[model samples]
Target chain A: MVLWIGGRAQGKLALAMQKWPEAKILDVSETDAKGKEELLRSLEDALKDERLVWNHFHLFVRRALLLGMEPSEIWEKVASFVDERPDLVVICDEIGNGIVPMEPEERRYREETGRMLCKLAAKADCVERIFCGIPVRIK
Target chain B: MMILIVGGSGCGKSAYAEKRIMELSLDGAMRYYLATMQVYGEEGRRKVQRHVELRKNKGMLTIEQTRDVSEALPKMQEGSKVVLLEDLGNLVANEMFGEDGAMTPWEIVADKIVMQLRQMNSSLDHLVIVSNNVFEDGIDYEEGTRDYLRALGMVNAELAGDATQVVEVVAGIPLMVKGKE
Candidate 1:
C-alpha cells in the first residue's frame, strides 16, 4: 500500500491525484460508518479494485472510534482489507501534531489516529510525507 | 549549528529531538534540555513528569525556563555545547500571557524570542528546537490565539531559515524538510 500523510492543506490529495490520475478516488472524510461492520464493509467495497486512492483514512478511523469500535478492531479490518489489496494509495491528515485537547474523547481519538497511522505506515510499501505541497519519501 | 524539529503533539518529535541531540553531542560535551513549559496543575505536573521520565538516564541536565529564552543561557554557559528546547509553543504562550512574561505586542514578542534564540544559539555548538504545527486545525480562533500563532509562525520561519536541519516527525518517523541526513 502507498501511504501519503501530512498536515491539513499540505496538498496530499492533490499529490495523490497527480501521481495516480487513473485511479479511483474514495474520500471518506465525511463518512459516518456507524460501526465496525459498516466501516469494514465500506473498506471492502472501496478496495475491490487496485489503484484506488483512499482519502481521509484518519477520519474514518475517528468515525469508527466514535461508533464504539476499538482501535484493534479498526486495525484488524484495515489490515485485512489492505493485505487483500496491497496496490492501493491512502491519504490521511496528520492530526496528532497539535496540542492535546481538554476533552478525553478528543485525546483518545487523536492517540488512536496516530497509533493506527503508525501501523499503516509499517505495513505500507511506500510512505511519503507531504509538507507545504512537497513530498518527502521516508519509507 | 541549529536543528529544528516540528510536528504535532505525541508524533514523536521529542523522541526524535532527544535521539538527534544525543547523536550530535560529542563525548564529554555538556547537554542541556531547556524545558519551556511552566508546570502548575496536576495535568501540567504529569506532562512534565512524563518528559522527565523520557530524559531519565540520558545524561542531560534539565533547565526550566518558561519565558525569556535567553534567561536560561547563563546557566548553560558553563561549557554546555548542546541544548534542546523542548518546544516553542509554550514559550510563546508564556511570553504572551504569563504574569511575569512580556505583555508586549505579538510582533515584539516574536522579535524578542528570535533575538533570544539567536543569542542562545550563538554560544552553543548545537541547538535542537522542538516546535509545533498548530496552524492546520483550521479553527478560527480568538484574537489572542491568532496573535500567538502569528508570533510562533514568525519565530519558526526565522529560525528554520538559519537552521542547519529541519525535520517534521510523523508517527516516530523523521522526514527531513531541510538539510541532508
Candidate 2:
C-alpha cells in the first residue's frame, strides 16, 4: 500500500490522480458511511477494483469516531482491509500541527488522526509527504 | 548562508531550528537570536518565557526586535555573526499592523519586508529564518487575514528562492525541499 500524507489543500488528491489515472477513487469525505459496518462494506466493495485510491482517509477516521467506534477497533479493521489490497493508495491530511482545539471532540479527532497516520505510515510500502504541492518521499 | 525553515504550529520547527543553528555555529562565531515576536498578553509572555528557557546555555545572545530587524545589525559584536530570526509570521504582522507599522497595501509591505530581510542577510555570516505553514487549513478567512497570508506567502517564496537551503519540519522530521542536506 502507498500512503500520501500532508496538510489540508496541499494537492495530495491531485497528485494521486495524476500518478494513477486509472485507479478507482473512493473518497471517504463524500461517503455517508455512518458506522463501522458500513465503512468496512464500502472498503470491501472498493477492494474489488484492481487499483484504488482512498481519498480523505482522515475523514473516515473521524466518521468512525462519531459513530462510536474505538480508535483501536477502527485501526484493526482498516489495517486488514489495506493488507488485503496491496495496490491501495491512501491519501490523508496531517491535522495535528495546529493549536490544541478548545472542543473536546476536535482534540480527540486530532489525536486519533495522528495515531492512525503513524500506524499507516509504518505499514505502507511507500510514504510521501506533500508540502505546498511538492511530494517528498519520507519512507 | 541563509536557510529557511517552514513548518506548521507545534510540529517542532522551533526546536529543529534551534538545533540546526547550534550545529551550524562555528567556533568563536557569534550567535544572535533575533526574536521578532512582540509579547502582547499573559499567554504571549508565557510563550516567550518558555522559549527563553529553551535557549539557556546555547551560547546565543537574544535580541528582541519586533520590527525593522535591520536595526539590530548595528548592535551585534564585530565578528562572524550567525543570526536566527525566530519567525517571519510575527515579523510580518508587526510590520503590517503594529502601532508603528506601515498602513499600506500588503504587497507593498511584503516588498518592504523582503528588502529589509535581504539587507539583514547581507550583513550576517549565516542567517536562519523560521516560518509557519498557516496556509493549509482550507478555511476562508476574512480579507484582513487573507492579506496577511498573502504577505507572508510572498515573503516565504522570495526568501526560499534566495536561501541556500529550505526545509519543512513535520513531526520533528526535517524534510529537505531545496539544497543539500
Candidate 3:
C-alpha cells in the first residue's frame, strides 16, 4: 500500500496505480471537506475498528495529531471502518502553488502540510512528488 | 544467386542498380529501390530526390525505411522476384535506436530484423542487397558506434543466413562470396 498526494493537476493517484498494481486504494478529497467540524468528528467516529490506514494527505493526520492523537492511535481508530485491513493507501495535495495564501488559515495549512510531508517521507519506505506529469523520488 | 555487393563511399551503387535493372529487362517485374536514409536535412532531402530521379522507368518503387526488415518486405512487388536494396549501411547504422542517441536492445532488434528477412527469403524470388562493408578500417568507437557495429554484424549474419548468392562490389568489381555464376 502507498499514499499519494499532490495538487489539482498532479496525477499522483494515476502514478500510484501504475506503480503499485497490487495496492488497494482509498481517496479523500476537498469535496468531503464541506463541513469541517462535522467531517472531523465523523471521521473520528469512523476510525474505531483498529485496522491499518495508509494516510494520503496531511489533513486527517494533522487534525488527529493537533488533537493530541498519536500516529498509531489515529491509524488504529481509522482501522475499524477499513475492514481491519492490513494495508491501504491515503492521499492528499501537498504542493499547490496556485497563489500565495494571504490569509492566516492558508499559511498554517501550507506550513503544517510541509512539516507533515517531511516527517512522513523520512519514515515511509517510498516517497514521491509529481511535477509536470513526471514523478520525482524525494525519499 | 546470392551475392554481397560492397563498394567504397560514393562508388555508384545507385547507378549500378539502375543499369542492372535495365539489363535484366525483367518482363512484368517489379524494380524497387529500398532506401534507408531519412531526409531530416537539406542534404538528405536532395539526395533522396536524386535517387528517385535516377530510376529508368515508372516500374521503380522506393521503400524509404531500409532499417526495418518488416517495412522492407511489404514494398516487394507480387510475382516480381528481382529486388534491389541500396545503401543498407546507412539504414542499419541509423534507425532502431532511441532519442538519447543510444542504440536499443540489439538482441530484440536483431531478432525482429532476422524474422523479417526470413519472411522475405520465402516470399521473394531473387534478392540483391548493397552494403558499404565498414569492416575495412576499424577505428576507436564510442558506445553508440560499437553498438551499431554489433547490430550491423547481426544483420550481416541474418542476411547471409538465407542468401544463396553474395557479391562484393569493390572498385566497380563484383566479387562473388557465395554464388554460382
Candidate 4:
C-alpha cells in the first residue's frame, strides 16, 4: 500500500506489490486522453476494492503532489477518506526533472518532494522508474 | 514439528539448516535434514554430491530427494526434536513442472503442487519453510506468470502466519523476526 515516486530508472522500486498475488488492480498506468474515462472508472473501482493500489509515482510530471501548509492541509482533509476507503491510486512525479535549481523555492520544492517519495517508497510494497519512456523497476 | 526453510537463490537456507543440526546436536538435540534439490545435471549433481560428502564427514543424517518430498515425512525418528524442510521454491517448480520437463497442462499440475505443499505444513513437526521473495520484478506480468507469482506469495504468507519463527537470511546472517528458532 506504499508508493515510491522518483526520477527515471525507478521502475524497479515499484515492483513489490505486483509480486504479491492477493494484490488486485484498482487501476494501472493510463494517461492518454482516450484512457481518461477508463482511468476514472478504475479509480472508482479501486475505491470499492481493498486490494487495488498503485506505484507509478512520477510519470504524471505535470501534477505536483500536494505538500506543505496549504497543500498539506488539503491532503489532511482527504486523509481520513483515504484511510477509510478500500481501493486507492497513488500518483508520483519527478520534480527533479533537470538540474537542481539555484533558486530557493525550486530547490526546496525538489528536496521536499524527493524526501517524501523516499519515505513513501520505504513503506511501499514496490517502486518503479521510467527512462526514454521505458519502465524499469527499482524497488 | 518439521522446520521449513524458505528463501531465494544464494540465501544460505541449506547451510543454515546444516549448522542448526550440528549445533542442536551439541546440546543433545536430535535433528534431520530433508532436502528437495536433486542431482539432475553434471554440475548440479556434483555440487549436491559435495554436500552429501560433507554431511557424511560430519556424520549427519541428510535426506536428499528430487521429488515427492511428502515421502520423507514419515522417516523421522520418534521423539525427534527438529524436522528441517530445506525448501518450498524448488519443490514447487519440480513437483508442478516436473524435474526434467514441463507439465503438458500447467494449471491442473500447479493445483496439485500447491495442494501437496499445503499438506506438508500439517504433516510435519516444527517446519521452517524457505522461499525467495520474488516481488522485486518491476515489469508487468503475463497472466500465467502472474498467477504462479501470486501462488508463491500466498504460500509464503501462510507459512509465515503459522511458523514459530520467520527469519530473513541476508549475507549469511539470520535476522530473527517472528519466533524462537
Best by DockQ: 2
- Candidate 2, A1-139: lDDT as tens digits: 9999876545677778888999899976677876678877887888899889999888888888998989989999889988899888999877776567788888888889888989998999999987655677899
Cα lDDT tens digits for candidate 1, A1-139: 9988876645567677878898888866555666667766777777666589999887887778888888898888889878887798888877775567888888888888889989999999999987645677889
In model 2, the runs with Cα more than 4 Å from the true position are A1-139, B41-56, B100-103
- Name the better of 2 and 3 by lDDT: 2
Deviation in angstroms for A100 in model 2? 12
Rate residue A16 of model 2 by lDDT: 82
Name the lDDT value of residue B49 in candidate 2. 80
Question: In candidate 3, what are the lDDT values of residues B1-181, reduced to their tens digit?
Answer: 3334555576665566556654444665666666766568888788778867766345677777746655777656567565666665676665666557666775676577667756665666555667665532223257666666566656664565466655545566655555554
lDDT measured at residue B171 in model 4 versus the true structure, 0 to 100 = 66
List ranges where model 4 is wrong by over 4 Å: A1-25, A28-33, A36-139, B1-6, B23-30, B76-81, B99-125, B141-144
Model 2, range B85-179, lDDT digits (tens) per residue?
Answer: 98999998888885854455789878988899899899888899999898755333687787887788778877877889889898999988978
* lDDT for B142 (candidate 3): 77
Could you tell me how far off, in angstroms, the CA of residue B124 lies in candidate 1 after the best superposition?
Answer: 0.2
Candidate 3: Cα lDDT at B65: 75
Model 1, position B124: C-alpha lDDT score: 90
Off by over 4 Å in 1: A1-139, B46-56, B100-103
Ranking by DockQ: 2, 1, 4, 3
Give residue A1's error in model 3 in angstroms.
68
Selected candidate, larger DockQ, 3 vs 4 = 4
Q: Fraction of reference contacts reproduced per prediction?
A: 0.09, 0.07, 0.00, 0.00
Better of 1 and 2 by lDDT: 2
Candidates in order, TM-scores: namely: 0.57, 0.59, 0.50, 0.57
Return the lDDT, model 3, position A12.
51
Residue-level lDDT of model 4, residues B1-181, one tens digit each, is 3333444467786678667656656654445556776556699878877876776687656787556766666765655444566566665556655536555244544455456656765754445456655543232367655555555555555455555656656667776545666
Docking class of 1: incorrect
What tens-digit string does per-residue lDDT give for candidate 3 at A24-133?
Answer: 44333332544445545655443443332343455565555555554556555554534344344455565333344676655555565666555545545555544322
